[model samples]
Target: MSDMYKAPQAELTNGEEHGDFGSVEKGIAGDYSFSISETVSEGWRLSKGKKRTVWLGILLYVIALIAITVVAGFITGVFTAEGDASFTQELIYNLITTIIGFPLAAGMTMIGIKIARGEDTSGTEVLAYFDKIVPLVIVNFLMAIFIFIGLLLLVLPGIYLMVAYLFAIPLVVDQNLGPWQALEASRKAVTKRWFSFLGFLILLLLIGLAGFLAVLIGMIWALPLLFIAIGVAYRKVFGSPHRA
Candidate 1:
């Protein structure tokens, strides 16, 4: 990693950068304050001078995405290639893919956390979360089920939960929390700043769209920015991990 990507070891001593959340602000949901602008700005600070490293991370991510898509497509092709596949078959295929794809999702989060922490990241880091596979898969599965149920009730609640639990994966991988614990922690951390999180998400989405529009190659770079931004938000919300 270049100096741009290297965070000084001294800064790592402070486990929680946001300080005690409840001490800062209170909300109807609970206490905990977050600044969407500050979080995004911190993300930019982490990413600003690290263009080369960020692009490398993105390239690895894109390659991984392509690989996963190809494998999923191949599996689907096997069952549906016969042309007699039914809705049930497709549903089963989707579930299978979701289960198998959990590791990649976790890997992506791990990469994001690493980048945010200024740790060295390489293509191999994409699969670093595989060792903690069970909890990662369980956490993701539970989050999806709850979010879907919430969506069934109303659009707003579902969207709320989506942002509420956005940090579950990072919590799981970074904090070593259980599935339920991670989900609940993520919910609590984001509860006070849900709207801000929404706005942040929208900003990232627009950035991603811009990447797509830029000759389709810009996503290779934009993807890292998105991940780093998320990392920044995660840090701002939950604070950094305790480094011994």
Candidate 2:
């Protein structure tokens, strides 16, 4: 554990770590304040030098994704070899892929969480969600629908919801939460410092973009940092009552 990753005393607007204040409505953040620098630094500390494991995990995840897509495509080709596949058939195939692939996404989160917790794990741990696939699939499906609707109605709301629910998958992976419980916990945890967390997300995107610019191979490292940063945020928000 680096000094930077050490839990610092929570700073309030009044400069008090803990105090009895009345129901005074804070301006941007409510009870909790988020520091973008602290969060990103913590993520880097967790991610640095762990690229080999993260890379292996990501490679396995990609292989699984490609395998699933190819299998689905092959199945569709086999069934529709006599004629062009119907639009309905294509839609159903896509739905099937989404359901199967979404749980794999949770597996990556599980790996990142384990790494952030300093636990030694194998890349194959990315398949840990197979035992608890149902809840993750349901959660991913509902999140997709909600996010899509929010995007359709207003762009800002969709982005806000996306950042707010950022920890939902990790919560499901680490805490074994059901679909709704994970989402609700994420919302409650992020709602207090939504804007700050949104800034943190933007910075991470920029970092990833920089990696993509570095001949694209840099993504293997950059993506892991992003995921680890997410794990850091998860721990900050929900790890223990002391941090909470």
Candidate 3:
């Protein structure tokens, strides 16, 4: 496999270089990830089998996501509280720039390390990825611009771009690709199983609605398990991790 598609930890074992292109169904994500797989699983054939690691990851991530969502809202509120130039105004600006402001590189790099090491990963892993790689964070911010422009044209394309590059951060960290290349590699991986990917995308949205109606717990519990299933399914359906 090209280094562009291989993990950083890839080594030529006695002159044979094979970098973790495991059975798609079995998961080649050992290198690292920042996924919307939960969102993706709503329609895909992926299965979220219950496991200690997956469950624990889900529980912790759900709590963290909820906390972050709440905190971001609070921050926005605080920004808005202080009149015209309040934090809200500043927040709107920051949110727009989060791709650039936060540690996009740090996230990818850390995930790379974890995946290479085949370690259990969590939200903190993402933060660590950001902490380690700083420059990519700005590029991520710029990529957001392209996404916004794509969205401005219409919603479908925006969603397409979103799904296409959902795994870009992971690809970049593990493979050392530049932003556009990462986007291309990520898009290729996802599109390799277009039907399956699309199917899961639709399924997850429906599940999300269900989760909404059932209250936040629906999202909390449904999301992780569903995602785990999708990730697993991606392997089975595509038979090749990189293709989809």
For all candidates, what are the clash counts? 0, 0, 25
Q: Model 3 residue 1 lDDT?
A: 12
Off by over 4 Å in 3: 1-81, 84-119, 132-136, 154-156, 233-244
State which candidate, 1 or 3, has the greater lDDT.
Answer: 1
What C-alpha lDDT do the candidate models reach, one value each?
Answer: 0.68, 0.69, 0.47
lDDT for each residue of candidate 3 in 108-209, tens digit (9 for 90 to 100): 333323323323454344444444245466447656877898899987777777776655554445445677766665666666655556666676678867
Error of 1 at 132 (Å): 2.3
- Better by TM-score, candidate 3 or 1: 1
From the highest TM-score down, the ranking of the candidates is: 2, 1, 3
lDDT (0-100) at residue 48 of candidate 3? Answer: 24
List residue ranges in candidate 1 displaced over 4 A: 1-33, 49-58, 61-81, 85-93, 217-221
Poorest 10 consecutive residues by lDDT, candidate 2: 19-28
* Residue 152 CA displacement from its true place in model 1, Å: 1.6
Over 79-132, each residue of candidate 2 has an lDDT whose tens digit, in order, gives 555568888778877877887877788878766665655555657777777777
lDDT of 3: 0.47
What candidate 2 gets wrong by more than 4 Å, as runs, is 1-33, 78-83, 240-244
Candidate 3 weakest ten by summed lDDT:
11-20
TM-score of 3: 0.53
